[model samples]
Target: MASNGVEKVGVLIVGSGPTGLGAATRLNQLGHPNWLLVDKEADAGGLACTDVTPEGFLFDMGGHVIFSHYQYFDDLLDTAVGQGDAAWNTLERVSYVWLKDRWVAYPFQNNISALDKEDQIKCLAGVVDAKVANAVAQGKPKNFDEWIMRVMGPGIADLFMRPYNFKVWAVPTTMMQCDWLGERVATVDVDRAIANVINNKEDAGWGPNAVFRFPLEGGTGGIWKKVAKLLPPERQRYGCQLAGLDKDKQVATFADGRQVAYDALISTIPLDITLRWLGQSEWADGLQHSSSHIIGFGIRGRCPHGLKCWLYFPEDNCPFYRVTVFSHYAKKNCPADGTKLPTLCKADGSGPDSSEAAEGPYWSLMFEVSESNYKPVAQQPTKLGGSAVAAQGTWPAVVAETLAGALATQLMQPGDEVVSVYHRRLEHGYPTPSLGRDGVLKQALPWLRKHNIWSRGRFGSYKYEVANQDHSLMLGVECVDNILFGTQELTLEHPNIVNPRKNLEMKYTREPVMPGLLASAKPMSAQEN
Candidate 1:
């Protein structure tokens, strides 16, 4: 990379995630050149990247959907992927929860009509009770469990909310705080529920991501790789992991002995790992997360369901909490229609391992299993992009169980041939909003900022509410603004304010007043919070 000596820059951005790219993109747009972005991985997108099977099928890390709340983010995406139908596949979000031997509409509380008569009655009663309780509920929920009870009542909570969330987070609802519950969970309307139940209707449109867009090719990774291409090539360095840090001297050493010192530092790495590199692991006491096992099954057949983009399974029958009908998103997700591949094994792994060549019209399903200290996955799924069946090592039959789970949940038939399989264990997937999270962040973030180091991203800030790509990008954008000028970081400091409203002031035009970024002289409403 760079020469042996330490190369000093005005600003050094670490980790080529959306957050880091946000800062770098802003700097480049401002025509500032005294900055560099470095990432250990060969590619950008971090956890947002897509991996390909040897058989030519593609699977993104997990189920990722773009739902923006900012005009700047929309502009950023359009600039990267090029605007219009040619660059994006804007599809309807046809999501269902596999429960009670049927595909029920999403936001289980709102679509009680899809359940059996008895269960529908129970859910409707719970919704009515929750409405009454919330009318007089004092203060805020003590925890996510309490919030669930107050919002949807115990029936929906026990059947769906509790079990589904536990599967996703691998953390008990009692231990999670409700402050991060702004636009995440759908709110149930008692009147709408009763009407839908009586009329046999489904209320599927409940959240912002009810409909989203994905890339037509290369999956989600295409977006970030394009964004990375937009920046000056000289300033971006890959394959250089941050080995250690000296906060006092503002110096960072890479794995290759290359070093960079900067007046201001922006790190998008996870806070816990960053602290470990800084040799202050004790400050990460409140940080906790669940590892994600992304399993993909590339099969040779037409999908039983049509236009069902993603499905959620809260029942114990499936090891995965959610499964995305990946091939439905884009034709490129699977191999070419006439391409031939071997039938490795059946989904249930019942047959003797065979290498019979097969042809396809292929469809794939991507699954996510959560693993944490509290609730662990049955096995550590094998690394992604390996052989379909050979990657299933001695670690408890994860691929086999996942296949069985899929059959039990009717995601696949008993004889569905597994043509291509892929698995990846992301060490830090979801950042848990534990009760003690605020206490640890208040202590750790300020300490890093005091050393002129700004840490911001999905795992960097450790706030799931602001952990989506758009929010993560804004965290970097605002953090740089905070560094350059004394601007307030609205996305980081106040998620509730940003989540609901449309923030449209940043057009990335014109210059600011002296000493600060009023860029465009058209002020962004950063002080709204």
Candidate 2:
């Protein structure tokens, strides 16, 4: 390790995310020691990290659940987070959509049984049109809005698809492209909808994540923290402020007057930031993204949110599009038994005004609200306390609306006491699959590759379809193979191939490890040591 000066390496990875960690892990397995990994965070889970409030409420960036298709990814999870049964909670996904003041088992189009007769008629008619259109329609969908109509028809689009998607993406369907939809969005089946509605049956098992697992203790962040540990300690650097990148000189300079030169560079940072560093910001001008506000509540009451894992809101009553019953996932999500925390406020904005603390058998709720050019959140948080209320929650004036929204949406009753309020704003949450995304990625990505730099991750690659933690991880693994042995990056180059089929290119199966024997055996990442 070069002490007081520049260091040169065979490969240099910027950002300690799944992508960076995946690359570092692969290189390590390949017996390559001349690689270095650096990140700005003190921790390894970039957007994947978890946060705890002063009152001991745990909140993730958003709701993250793992549904792996790659054996390589499955093996990495075991090596990091571990194969121990105590490390995770295997879950049966119980998701529902809030529509017309009733909870419909999710994939709204398929569960018309829960809808009113009027809605059922409307949706079924639309499905009929879609089936007819599918047979005769030519070329590809011009945009997401057209695609929705072509596949789901006008009735479903008007009643739920259009509004719910707009809330989640913070962009109208008309502005996005349909190519990234792959397995992410469910396609409406005409026969299934008709049968479910007529027979009064529910169809919830539609996607790959029909069953999933989450870390037993920490949120989704726990998995990445483990993977970042499998590299040489001395080569991993954390808390280093990245100043600039001189692409021409093949150098990365830190704010503290240190530099590293690399034969090949792998960046997991957002493409816009990377381009800006390389002094070519214009190439990424067409990119669009939505910001996210994670509003969490630690409550002191009977948990009204039952075994349902998460719920979606399409009505205007709530500021959030989705709310996860966080406490149901793990006991450690909230403060332990009898641990006292000051009551922040009630769900109805009533409270213990002073610094008065109380004990709990607590439960929590985590909400996600999206913002974009069309939908905006406040730049500055409004200075409001327990007695204050906003007319309707808009961005910036968050707290009052969030609380009121909870009450309005019936997630919380008027008497539900709020023990803790946790709010976090993430500037770049979801990468919009906009109509112009492919054009921009095509031009920018190939040019970067020409310079021996591979941008591959959520924002690095700028492909939302392949932006999950697993996909991001494989992008790094594949990029390394492409760098060293010229392997095809099936994950990055073809998301369609990897998203549906279980990629058994690499496979490992293990029986669940016994719990309690190693419950406290937490492995430290390379930098932590």
Candidate 3:
């Protein structure tokens, strides 16, 4: 600690998630020592972290699979936690959408052939109409709903796109924008839809995450914990909350009364919260976000959903929009097969025939439910883990609802034994792309930059298109380069460019000199303070 409890550094990074860690890693790799990293959480990996139940079951905050679009990100993870089968499990994506009581192949627009005869006719006709309308369309889609209609027509939109998205975003499609749908969504092909329906073929592969990797152990958070290890521990501070920011003075005050003055501040905090701290809460109205309710169940039995990594839910039969076979990702996700455990409840949420502990195999399911002002969720006391008591309308009620949903979706049996239950609610889950998002960001980001502050991260920049783990990390890395050398931040500025293809411009190791980042144009001095 500096004397007078006022430390000075070139850059002060807030939040130790992927983005903050990425910024720190880049600064260190470039040999910049006068910087500090702090996070409110006791550990790194913000929303990407994982939680384990007392019965020995691990669950990530949400579905986080690494599908890297940058070689730098790929290399960082490889260096942090070795490469190949030893450190990761490379799995082919086998995803589906559970609707109409049947499993539809993923990229539902491309696989409408899985529907019944009448439904197939309805969807095929819509695709044909959309293609015809698109050929002579007047202007681009005004909102997400318009885009869905233009690409998928009314039948597909009415059946799946609208309902599924409403459940996922917890907001009406009409209230959201469409520019962020670069590669995140799959557009329907009129001819392909027709051909698939005629031949009864399934078009499963469409988007970027066709094949992805998961850490062999410790879940998704394990990867970041290892990445944080690569940085100097003395420079990293965990469990430090930012009380307020003095942008004009270039100083940050912590809740503990510790203050740090920086030449340039790189903040990964949510843009809305940052604005509020800066006393500019008026600009935050344009920013919209949805909350997430993650529920997990550890059951004693052999895995039933074989090779089925994840499945989506669209109907009212379930509360969650998606569920992942967590144990299928890795065996270590569950307790040892022989480990003894008593049943909490049957899949129907009824009392078990016997409460005696028994040894057996184990499997787990993780579910995600979205919530927002537009879509309110049942608020109740959250269940932490491990034999915690929960009554109706609390964690137990939520779990009961989820189990009933599973049974309704045929993912669970009525008498299945649930050994462990876990539930956690993330206040800031997904950064929504609202209709007025771009307008607000255009002003707020530049305004922050003028104050020597760089707001970049999942919620910092608030660009859902580039808010993935890899993109979030690069936001930090690119911000550091921009601050030091005036280098263009591609991931932040040109998400469409960096997202569609591999970004090989930067490397992990300082090897061949890279162009475009002019040293003479370097702005801030790391040793200024």
Candidate 4:
């Protein structure tokens, strides 16, 4: 505590998710002792947390896979948890698109050979038109829709790109900007695509997460929980809801009347909310975000999906845009085969044959439904006529809808016994890359930094392209380095440079000698530490 009767630290970190944890980890490793980490939740891992049902089924907040682009991030994971085969499960990505009532190999544009002959011709014709147009193209695309047409043409745009993106973002593609998309969306390679079509082959190997690792014991949240454990317990404070931030005084007041004064602050709170707190609410209008409704079902059956990880849904047959066979990630994700649980309802939303608990050779599916102003969701009422609604009486309408959708998509059979159900609504699910996002960020981030505040995370900086776990963590790590040594924040500034290639410059023990020195810095030798 400071002499002025306010708690004080060299740095005060808000939100103990990957961003805060990364900042804390780097500070601790650098022997910096005067920093404190706080989070509103009782546990860490903000959007990356996991929830376990009463029947012991585990579902992550959303589909999360680790496809790291930095060696420093890999080092942190290895340091937090063991790197051996026992600690992790390296799985091949067997992802597909649920289209025309059939499973098409992922990167739909490249796998048009699976489509009907007439549809395949449409796709091929569009690709030919797109290539011809590109040879003498004009200025850059006006928006995301234009970018799509420029890259893959109208056939794919109408069939998959437009509809699929609208379902995922809950907004029209015209409202989105194209600059944020570098390697995020797969573009067609005309020659290869044509060759594959002629050969009647599938091109399933496209994205960065084609091969990724997951923690064997815990869900995605378990990884962050382990990372938090690496930090000193005394340095982390939970249940500290931030009430106000005084930029002038460099002090943060909690909801409970506690105050923490700091020389610098690293905030992972959503940028819109942060702007509201700073009395700059008007600037928040430039940012657009979509809320997520995640629904999970634990079923009693052998895994029917086999090695399939996730499937995309673009049609209106399902409310969700994506569903993942979450149990396929780890054996511990589902309850033991002998564990018993009752069936809440059938896949068709009908009553089960028996209400009695049954044993499960279990599997689980998690679905993500996007919601925005353009797409509103039907939420169950908390109270009506001054009385609280019963859980059974007021079942979430979305859950029932999702059950029907699962059947419609053939994800669940007619009478598959559902053992457990989980649904969570994340208000700030995805930070959308809207047309005006960059303009707002350019002004707001620098203005906050002038007040000794560094806002960088998934929702913090609002860059969806670099909002993965590894990218989020590195944002914090880079922000800390910028504060301490005036180093360039490549991840924050030039996402294009840091994203497409592996960054091996910053190892765990290696320390930079000067500011603006990344490429010149050498990794510390094995015996240095």
Q: Report the number of the highest-TM-score candidate.
A: 4
lDDT of 3 by residue, 272-339 (tens): 99998888788888899999999998988998888999889989998999999999888899988889
Task: List per-prediction Cα lDDT, in the order shown.
Answer: 0.83, 0.80, 0.85, 0.85
Candidate 4 structure, TM-score to reference: 0.94
Instruction: Using TM-score as the measure, name the better of candidate 1 and candidate 4.
Output: 4
Better of 1 and 2 by lDDT: 1
> In candidate 4, how many Å is residue 487 off?
1.0
* Clash count list over all predictions: 2, 3, 0, 0
Q: Candidate 2 vs candidate 3: which has greater TM-score?
A: 3
The estimated TM-scores of all candidates read 0.92, 0.91, 0.93, 0.94
lDDT of 1: 0.83
Tens-digit lDDT track of model 2 for 124-235? 9998989898789998989999999999999999988899899999999999999999988999878878999889999997777778888888788777887776667787
User: TM-score of the candidate numbered 2?
Assistant: 0.91
TM-score computed on alpha carbons, candidate 3? 0.93
Candidate 4, residues 234-293, lDDT tens digits: the string is: 999999999999999999999999999999999999999989999998789889999999
Give the root-mean-square deviation of each candidate in angstroms: 4.0, 5.8, 4.8, 4.3
Q: In candidate 2, which residue pairs get closer than 3 Å at backbone N, Cα or C atoms, i.e. clash? A: 377-395, 378-395, 378-396
**What would you estimate as the lDDT of candidate 2?**
0.80
Global Cα lDDT for candidate 4: 0.85
Candidate 2 residue runs with Cα over 4 Å from true position = 1-4, 353-355, 383-396, 501-529
